[model samples]
Structures are given as C-alpha cells and as structure tokens.
Target: MAERYGVVPTRRQRLPLVLGVLVSLVLLAWLLWAAWSHSTPAVAGGLTSYDVVSSHQVRVVVDVSRQDGDPVTCTVSAQAEDHVVVGEDDVTFPAGPARTVQTTMTLRTEREATSVAVTDCRAGSGGPGARAPGR
Candidate 1:
C-alpha cells in the first residue's frame, strides 16, 4: 500500500467531502423535524379504564386529545382471553370546542371478553396510520 501520511488532499477531494457533510446535515435536520412533528401528532387517545359488564358486553372509557375543531374517530376493541377480537367498532368524536374528550361506550361482544381497549384513532378514516390514538 502507498504511504498517505504526508499527502494533502486536493481541492477536488475536499469538495466532495464538504458536499457530503452539507448533505448529511440537511438530511439530519429534516429527519429531526419530522420526528418531532410526528411525536406530537394531530390527535392522541388512551384508555383510562374498562369493565367486563356481562357475558356479552364490555364497557370502556376512552380519553382523547386533539385540536379543538377537528373531529377524530377511534377504533375500540374487545378481545377474548386468546387475544382474538370479540367486538370492534369505530367511535367518532364530534367536532366541538374542546381539545380533550372522555367518552364511555359499551361494546357488544360475541362472547365474554378478557380485555377491552382502544386499538387505533385518527383524524379521519383515511390514512393507514397517522401516528397515534390510544395507549
């Protein structure tokens, strides 16, 4: 191998290095901004509590936070002991002058469910996954 210990990089070599560094910085900044925006999303939801009311029903309380004017829909599900969905449905929070909402609803199940939870929540029934809704 040739010794490169005393060799100075030419302008051509330094140009590519500088360009690569600039491109890397820009890409990193964009990535950070994207992550920060997504972390705070447009809406978020969580399940505060649930009740196995009967052999065919489960009552769940969902708490959601979002922009005051945009209506959001959340999917809630009841699962059997085997982790199979016994009941699932979409709950739409109507647009109003509130950023946070706590809703309680009962899901009629095919059989007794071992657990109930809010699966996914979004601004509209469109995107495959917006970010969050339910924890």
Candidate 2:
C-alpha cells in the first residue's frame, strides 16, 4: 500500500464533493417543504362510541376531518383481548364540507372484538362502500 502524508485534495476532486453536498441539501429542503404543505389532520378524533352489538360484531362511531369536500376513506379495526386483530372494515365518508364529521361504522369479526377504533382516514374521491371479510 502506498502511504502519503499531509496531502490536500485538488479543486477538481473537491468540486464533486461540494456539488454532491449542495444537491443533497436542496433535496432535503424540498422534501421538508412538501411534507409540511401536504400534511393535514388525518384523524380528528378517536372512537366516539363503541357498542358490542353481538359476540361477533361491533358498532363504532368516529369523528373525521379533511380540508375539502372530497370524500374520505377510513379503516376501522376491531381487536380482541389479546390485541389481535379480529375484524377490519373500510368505510367511505361522503363529500359534504371541510370540517369534522361523525361517521358510524360496523365491523364483523370472526370471534369477538374487545375494542374498536379508526386506524386511518384520508381524503379522496370515492363512493361509500363497505370492504369487510366474508361480505
């Protein structure tokens, strides 16, 4: 191996290093701004009410919000005592206003659901429908 002491890199070598750092900085800045601008309150509130309709079913109510009148889709999940997912459903929110909305969703479980909650909510153009297992 050849060893050199107190060697300084030439301008040609340093140019690519400096340019790479500058490019990385610009990319990071753009990502930050894009995230900040597109970010919106996904879940406005938690489960408003949860009713155990039966041993294999649950009725859950949640409050969701968005920035426009576009419809929103939410994933409602039910968990058992062991925190295992027993059931899940995707319910759509109709377009109305850019404000908080109270949505009721029904989930059918294979066993029993000890707790239910809205996992995710997002705004988009879609119609109201139910996506549940064995439906």
Pairs with steric clashes in candidate 1:
45-134
lDDT for each residue of candidate 1 in 52-132, tens digit (9 for 90 to 100): 999898888988898756878888889999999999877777677799988888778999999888888788643443223
Stretches > 4 Å off in candidate 1: 1-10, 125-135
Q: What tens-digit string does per-residue lDDT give for candidate 2 at 82-123?
A: 999999877766678657777666788988889888787766
lDDT of 2: 0.75
Residue range with the least summed lDDT across 10 consecutive positions in model 1: 126-135
lDDT by candidate, in order shown: 0.81, 0.75
Candidate 2, residue 56: CA error in Å?
2.0
